[model samples]
Target: MKTITKYIKISALALVATFGSCSKILEEQPRSIYEPGFFETERGIMGGLTSMYAHLRWIYGQAYWYNTLLTGTDEVTYAQQADQNFLVMDLSGRALMNAENSRADAIWGICFSNINTANGIIEFAQQVDGVTEAHIGEARFFRAFDYFLLAQTFGGVPLDLGAGELTFNTSTTRSSVRNTVPEVYTKAIFPDLLHAAEHLPETGRVVGGVTKTLARLYLAKAYLTYGWWLENPNNIPTYPAADRIDPDGHDAQWYFQQAYNVAVQGIENPGPFRLQQTYYDVNLATNDRNNELLLYADHTETSEFYNGGSLTWGNGGAPDNFAGWMLTWNYTEIRSSSSSSAWSAVSSVQREAAQALGRPWVRMAPTIGALSNTFADKTNDSRYDGTFTTVYRGNWNKAGIQGPLYNANYLPVNPGDAILTFLNEEPTQAISYGAPFNSNVGAGVLPGRADFVISPSGVSRRIYPGLWKLGPYRTDSGSGLGEPNAGSTRPFTAAKFSELYLVAAEAAVKGASTRAGFTARDLVNVIRARAGVWRWDNNGNTERIEDNSAAMIASTPAEITIEYILAERSREYFGEGYRWHDLVRTQKWTQLASSYTICGPNIGDRTPIVFQRNIENFHYLRPIPLGQLDAMEGDRGIYQNPGYD
Candidate 1:
């Protein structure tokens, strides 16, 4: 894209200090103009490296780019109040995804800009005084980091933006050429990460900076993804029409074994990073930036300047952490009675800056399969409770509505009482529909219950569970509802330590030889064992301490297939922007996510409708952005992916 040419001329810095670290390492002033000779100094190299972390906010937690990761997958679909930005991505024959409207353009622009800044640092930092190889390794990790994302999304990307191969470009050029998939992995991604792993320190320089463990995680992941591309088990198509042959003489089995070896190395020598004691503690907003998280796109509730967005109101754009608002239905519409005798309704549930309730956009909703089939073991597994806000309690007293309000079956509800609940299973008792309460949404009433409820089969687009992990949390919200319109201040998690175990397991499933204690089932059970422990019951709003690890391990099948690993990955990392990449890497998008069931996008609609996606073999690779194709001096047909052209 032309943004690469423009970014080289200007330097932008949005340095943030959310975690406790050395102040000099995390703070820097912004620069307007970046000359070609500026990189020869130590200050210029530090500023450029900090901007690489800041640019991740442009893609990770932004709402539109979040839609590109999830909407077509089996995890989520478009909701009642969805706009065209979310609808076209469902891929259910409503509208086709073309180069213009696909939000993958956000990744194209942001990654290329960061890659150019990294190239400048690596080329000029060696001549500067008192610069170590560890400082240069940080830049190398970010360069490979962005290229791996680009290679996975758009199959073959341009290694040379404007200048020669892997060089920093100073002048503008219009001509571009696409590199092959093997060239990107072997020539750019693998080499940079290998240098980073060898030269980096064990611990990070800053609070969340790059280190040897972080480099090994990405290197192992790239090796595993490249091995699947070489195998081509499903015969999915690639862009630029290159044959699936490694430039090096290694086969797919060699890459898989390398992936397993590196992942095991990272797991053996984890520096200050380990799995959390329970699944609930891993995602709790108060426990953010914990030891389990390796990398994140951080934001602060303390400062609007360092947070890169407003602290009061977010406009749902880049540098704003508003991905949580997309799946949140409007819980403010739920009502209770002012008088128990008549039908005088009072709005019971108000939006608050709590972990369970946040501002609602109603743009995306979870499917029936995600609720019922994926999380079937709700009794023993705590991930379903930790991942979703199933119970929405009343806060009408905090919103200045006193007196005990009446709810379903004419029962009383106070401030902390349950207002609405997304039930775990379909109740055997008869459900009473429409009454003194406003059943405008698809909620029904049970006998002598104070809360309105909707079973798993009754979940609709207008009313469903909110994503509890990504919801809003702030210490400034005292006894009142604090800034509900503001973007979330929590750091969006990018990579974690627990993924090292899953990566080794996936590689072992692909014909890599296993060690004694690190078999495929043994590695997966490490994650499943943690899912059994519970410190808090999220839906019940009570403290529940239990250990069901033996039951969880007993339920595992004797033989673990790739399909079983995919299911466990979903239960562990659902709604964290990992679904599409997982499906694409295994070439199981068409086999697993071809059809899904969800209710229609209306208030009172509850009938499960099965929708079919027109997924073709040519759809394995996403099209190049229209802006990139428009700026280059070549034939557009040759520049784009096959089916989109």
Candidate 2:
């Protein structure tokens, strides 16, 4: 049974004051209106459980920060300038330092707050009468989920299982990095998920319990990450040596097989979700039955509250458009030009002139440049259509122009150029050119010009070529709901089912094959078929079949598995937040950081850059905030992880 918890009406000042005092102060303050005593009844238990779900708002809202920080910059690049914060991080090459304080604080506080609430629920739910085993199972599932996130980011965090037996003490020493990787998995995460699976109903099922399918999903992820860490401990720096339990213990493959088993169980369950026939078919605008592969999702449509819809466009703000909607300067255009004789002449002149002036046009690496060529191919590949919007000629009613116009460079005047024109009241000439042109040009007819010559076709003629699918069309004046420019309203694009197929494929290769489940090749084939690619034998390997089948078929599964996972992730989830973490987890940071280059105004050729992972200071996790450290006392060594000064 679903229940709702109305938010408590406490003033912001009161909340600040209450938490500001030490644990002793907390005791003196008036107790919360709704305490453990109030939640001893069935209705109260239900309300408490529902409040746990409320915490999900914070999690999903915080996703933008994670997605942007992870994807933008050398770690990842925005296709356009709509969301420039992440792009600026890449451009500036700064560490994940205290400079971005609010986001850091939000992440830290929200996770802990959720954990605290879950603790209260878990502790009190046990004492409530008429509360079935299912309530206990839900509380455990949420507790484990919260811990899973904490474990992922801040390794070996203090495990607070319940409200303290003693009074809340602000000066307590933090627990030692207690659980080993396997130990944490076995002790905290796995037990809760297993219990949840036992209590949850079968597929086509929803109750007060987390369904069996959801438990299997969580377990599958745990097993996969565990296997990856055991095999490649060097990649995950946050928990060094945690993966190495013993020199001669069970191999990485064993853990992977376990993950595979759980994934198979989830796949075999008769869930309502499945992959959409095409990538374009998944939309919030359509009232479709959510999909077969969605293990769990917040069904509430609070897009406004959490700003999920705003992410459809670039980062949300004025003066800057959304990141996903802006077009980037196509390096392919520059590369192709560099290779041509005519372009060679122009480039040679530009190069010599720049060299004389101690500047040069930035050039991307040959390998990175190949991505554009690959994407530009107008094939029946599903990704091309799914990922990029097509360019076409159209009138810009605002500008009173009729021709193709690239969205990236859509401003009326080049902000950097130093020229201006003014209207003149002469019959033959409508406007006159002016000198000392430091001001912006106003819209008017130019003298001796018949009409504006808009380019029919060129790189500059397209807007946000690859990242333009954030939402549907809207007027410039922000009138309609779900329109691109509507005030405080935006379109929606949820990442859905097709990704599960990729997950299943990767899981299958790593040991997830069960009798009832699809093989890696089978999963890939199904996805490729949706992309309009015809299937061939290709030796029954997903990676090989998808990535130039002839060449990859000869490679071993281990070699093929990594390659397939990376390529599939890049093609399927490029603009999303997965790439940076993917690179970090696989230990490819140093290579990619050193190899890639950026091009834009103010950034020239030979300008070296490095991602946070490449630097030594970033090896250990980022420091807990200074304020948090100050609140604790004695044995700082126990509180902090290794590698800090």
Candidate 3:
């Protein structure tokens, strides 16, 4: 990542107020009110350290872009197709143009921001008398972590080792993509991580400081990346040929083994942390310890509350609650009192909408169907239950009303328009539909009705039920009038612990060859047992589909190669940002090109819609933005990567 300079331009006198003791900490100080001299005091130094924590916030929050755009797209097979979503572009053969167009820029910005904050903290904390060595170690650990993110994203980013010299200008050009992947791993990230592992106490020492396990976790990830990056057989300095090799030509296996060793160390000496037991425990709202796997970050309730809702609209509420609309109600069936009666009333309207929209009412393509069916069969797997809600209908209640009878699966009885203006109009008369409701309601109130009548033929009348149960509102009437408070009382966002288990499983599988402590089959069985699978076995012949029930279980080690790992990662971490990088790292861009189909205004009938995976060059790199290139002076070799025109 390009290390952007952020000089704290505060007055020397005001610095005292800025870095003073926690009691004297300025809650409402002006942004420009800084006093470098105050930074000399113990309280001032601690205050400055608080600012570093704030910087860490940016890193944790910024992962959503990768989670949403890269992972949720065809980059990984985690996400199935959806209508009118940007991921469709990648899935449907769209070339990501430059850094400006790609969402990765936000990740770059967040990571660099973390690096700057760490640098500032390290530089300033050293000047204080009572400042402990542990504090300095923490700062260095964060700095290394920030740089690690840069390396993973951009591959050889400029390294900024120390605070800038007086001659350092903000306009100083980027350093050459110096430090090969191995060099960055060894010289920059590894040293800091190792130092952190040694000096940083146990996990509960502080809220967001580095721990021994976290350092190990990061080291494992870095080593894994190193192995992947180095295992290119086509490269000039290839390892001994597979046929001539002693261990069946498994060069990549060595790197995976290193990663595994680190992970095992972390697992054994997990400090104060431990894995979450249940699916609900992993969520930010409910899980207090956050999980043994989570290295650092504030474990406050606000962090939990802030992280909910869909990709389009953040944690849903009054003004910005459009995310509910973006959701296509296809997962569970929307059954009425009787299937025949509801279908008779609503099927024709649904057919018309399908014909006009040129898409199915329930957008379950072959891919989605396959995956959903697979998840259905894997009931024993904790991930299947944790990631998705299996219960067809949980108790539902009206927004303001309070009554046991009122709690039922409330499906929308109308579909007026795709736009929001049509949604606010509530349907009065209930239309009976089958498992998945597809009905519409009309506008305006009818006789003896307080709400708008269900249009016997409109789209709004169609039943599309949301998966989770809605929170209770204030009223006894079931008219859907009350709204939940944003800060308090809202539906919880489920982030299952099963994901952490999957990460552990992958690490274990990769590490099996080197450690001799545990085999891949053993790791797989552990996860299977957790999921309650009766047919669990370590025979190495059991095949498991990535997400779908239809995948043939692998019977051989060759079958459980990188592709299988990628598939498992997709199924386990879908919608959480694992797919995007997996696609790039595994050179599976061609598979991404094959799965998508696009339809919209700017896009015409682009047949055989697909993106070519330029793996030889483009896979490991992204093009620098043309606008940035234009703005920079001189050759600005910094602005252009190797293959761009």
Candidate 4:
């Protein structure tokens, strides 16, 4: 880690930041705010606010940063063709995440820049005419949002970025100091969120704008996280070496109670947000930006200007929604024979901009535990179907191949038939692994089946269920594969309304006093009940109308424990970038994600091998970016997180 001076400088440079449609169905404009007195004008305030929203693109949808969020978790691990960027984060004895190589570094600069812009807006917005409390409240919300993320990932961070604490810094100062965790929560995160929740409007002016509910969601989440820090039940260490004491004179239980109260309040006053009708609808590509999504980094298929990146081709960079590509295995390698007797194979499952098949980077894969254990009751639960693309259907006709051709077991398959299917469970008969009959992507052949089938236990790092929730979608494919190479145009969901229930339940389990009708078990059952409803069978590829809510509720334990809450959270938010933070907050990362089972990266390696993670106590907090250290003045040892230096 080395030291530089402009770390404190606000990045209010002129740029085109697109704000998604708010009051109108479609709206976009460029807003440029320069540093000098920019915040004194209404336009500057507006531009700065837009940048706050735009910064999410750099963090949420960016694949490398996404790797930081889930790669080492119980959900996923590094996949075939993974570079060091993916490998280091896996924490599985491959390599450690140093400051230079860590993709968590991506958030460091972007968040600080946005925090400075937010500081500018909050400081100067009152001087501008027509700047409402709501406007300033948005700034406060973003400022706290960034700080919350930073604190969670890197322990304590600098509040005074060369300007005094929470002030707009115009001067470039090299020196920086880290704030303690409690100081960050009480001084910056909690105060800002509380103010924003009170002053912000009930609903957002724009589709993904910050609203009171969104603010309260973060507020509750922050309180919950801080409470865990204060409790330190596992005795995990914190950086900047501060004691586990709340500056507000509140104990861990008090904060947990506050978390419960705020989450309950948000649920009670959900304004325009609510749970989608079914779990499938929540992450359906077409149903994106639905009522359940509180905030998202928006992109569109209509225009590149509005979308912020090329719609037809993505370079796998920031501002491009390409996190979908990471989990996507090369389905294009799936082969179907043109002849019945001869082993003449043709690529059948070509890459397409469908919800199931997209451009595959094969950089990350879900763990076997994620499939077999986490989603154990695959038959009863609809989440496994909704969350992943378990079956790869034939679309060779779209690629100009007439498939009345023979597939696995030399079975006749037509266009729109099942090409490759990841079986829900191990079949009664032994899966045929090697032959002229099997597919190249390590999928096995089941007797009398046209599709190449891989059992849940046989899922490899190279071939497994792709994430369907964040996959690509397009209306313009027009009887052919359309824009499979493009970054996903659907908005990347960052927050959901269903989390209020989970958050409240988690707090309740942590000894927060319960309110009537909102007990810990009651809150969790609401989510479980919704998981029972099904509008579509994702694996079977058919319409399935069913209401098994009572069954789902009956399955839930009467005494809801923290473990159950964590499991349910995984079921709901799997592969959506919540696992790491959730596990870290509960001090359950090492316990839950310490060891995972996955087959080798090579094709045809279906032998599951257990891999152990080298998740040290210090590994909980990600290393501070080496670039930040290079730019700062003074002892960088004091600035970086422990064990990284």
Each candidate structure's count of clashing pairs: 0, 18, 46, 8
Q: Write the per-residue lDDT of candidate 3 for residues 151-190, one digit (tens) a residue.
A: 6665655454233421112333433233444555666677
Q: Model 2, 1-645: lDDT tens per residue? A: 000011122211111112221122111122233455545766555544554544443443233344433443232443233233333334334333432331333345444544544555566776877776676676667767766665554465545322242111122233323344455566667777788767755542232224566666776666676566677745545543364553337667776777766765666663554666554444322323345334222322234332323423334332122323223223212111112112221111111100001111111111132134334332445464444323211112222322222211122222111111111112343332222111111112343332212111111211113232332233233321233332222222223445555556666776654454377766565555555532321111122123332222322143336555666566655454455555555555454443443232221112222224333424324344344444444555455445543
Residue 235, candidate 4: alpha-carbon lDDT: 94
State the C-alpha lDDT per candidate.
Answer: 0.86, 0.40, 0.39, 0.87
| Least accurate 10 contiguous residues by lDDT in model 3 | 351-360
- TM per model? 0.97, 0.63, 0.63, 0.97
lDDT of 1 by residue, 1-645 (tens): 465676555545434223322443465445555555867877677777777788788877988888888888889888889888888788888788889888888788778877888888888989988567988898899999999999999998888978877888887877778898999999889999999999988888877788899999999999999999999998888877789999998899999999999999999999889999999999999999899998888899988877878999999987999999999999888888887778678888898988898889999999989989999999999999999999989898888888998888888889889988898999989887875556656688998789999989878878889999999899998899898999999899989999999999999999899999999899999999999998889889899999988889889887888988889989999899998899999998888888998888777787888989988887677778888888777688988998887
Which tens-of-lDDT digit does each residue in 269-341 have in candidate 4?
A: 9999999999999998878889999999888898997787998899999789999999998888888888999
Which residue runs of candidate 4 sit more than 4 Å off their true CA positions? 1-33
Model 3 scores a TM of 0.63
Candidate that beats the other on TM-score, 3 or 4, i.e. the better one: 4
Candidate whose TM-score is highest: 1
Error of 1 at 623 (Å): 1.5
